[model samples]
Target: MLGQAKAFSSFSTNDIQQTKAFYEKLGLNVKVEDMMGEMLIMQLNGGGTVLIYPKPNHEPASFTVLNFPVQDVEKAVDELTAKGIKFEQYKDLNTDEKGISHQDDFAVAWFKDPAGNILSVVKDK
Candidate 1:
């Protein structure tokens, strides 16, 4: 066997409802399941999951970050922008006029979830 490779993946957030809604607004169906103490879990379609636990009390092994594969870069960005998604840009990093970066086989766009989780979308190769 080639082994299991990588196993499960997840991230943490501050608020369940707001985080869920934020992903939903980005065209992802973020599902909220179970509530334990001040913590909750949310799943983002096809992109793994995020855990939403109360702030100032929960500590995670590491912060969650994600990179999504998309079919088209510009169209995806347009759709997200139409829904009020704002992208971050760094002048030090090469960004197009539309704030996306096209490098080699990958074209990328970026945004964040409600609780400050950084995320990116790249053209599926």
Candidate 2:
């Protein structure tokens, strides 16, 4: 049925231009379109797309809206941090100095966009 259909995710931001610039700085190929409404299409390096639209009263998601799987969580954290991205710290999760938390066999780190939408980088298992 719909199992083979390509699916994409969409989220809202208070400012489209600021959100677009934040993502572009991280090296993601972003395409801006203005159809019925303005949208920023994020082309992920691993073959996926996310649509970001502008909203007048947008509130960032409390939970992670996107997760990027990386080969090395440490290296990924380091690079992103050096690019001025601040990682979130969860005290109870026992995060390291890099703000990465490890549990079981995987590691994960979280950060937020200019709109305060949470996003994460996780160890590819």
Candidate 3:
């Protein structure tokens, strides 16, 4: 039986500082513990959070990687790019363009967090 949807997911980042900074731009705070390159948490202001580790010990999750719901995917993309986050570009895939409004049916954009972890922002349906 499926229980509650994931509250958060985690990724292994090479640089924890940059990783933390990237999500911080998304209004997620860094929940850090002792500096052993152990586990790190990044929590969004009003929603879910993500755990980041230096090296992944368990199996890699072959899934959405990270999902974040936003009010405006375009605005989120613009704001994030302004902060130096690069949205993944695929010629075959339709991506967010222009200002803060992607009417791509569901208004969405995909990018990598500072940790090279795949993440997407979609308007709540």
Evaluated with lDDT, which candidate comes out highest? 2
Model 2 stretches astray by more than 4 angstroms: none
Model 2, 15-72: lDDT tens digits are 9899999998888999899966888999987679999999899999999999999999
Per-residue lDDT of candidate 3, residues 1-125 (tens digit): 44776657666877767666666667777877656755688766566776788864434344448777877777777787887777765555555353223554676667766555677877877
Cα TM-score of candidate 1:
0.75
Q: Write the per-residue lDDT of candidate 1 for residues 9-121, one digit (tens) a residue.
A: 56676676777677767666555565665544545565455555656553433322778788998898888888888876757668777668877777887777777777887
Candidate 1 has an lDDT of 0.69
lDDT of each: 0.69, 0.93, 0.67
The per-prediction tally of clashing pairs is 0, 0, 0
Model 3 TM-score, 2 decimals: 0.71
TM-score of 2: 0.94
Output candidate 1 Cα RMSD: 3.7
Q: What order do candidates take by TM-score, descending?
A: 2, 1, 3
Worst 10 residues of 2 by lDDT: 30-39
Q: What is the Å distance of residue 52 in model 3 from its true position?
A: 1.0
Off by over 4 Å in 1: 1-6, 38-47, 57-64
User: After best superposition, candidate 3 residue 21: deviation in angstroms?
Assistant: 2.0
After superposing candidate 3, which stretches have Cα over 4 Å from the reference?
Answer: 1-8, 35-37, 45-47, 56-63, 96-104
Q: Model 1 misses residue 101 by how many Å?
A: 0.8
* Clashing residue pairs, backbone N/CA/C < 3 A, model 3: none
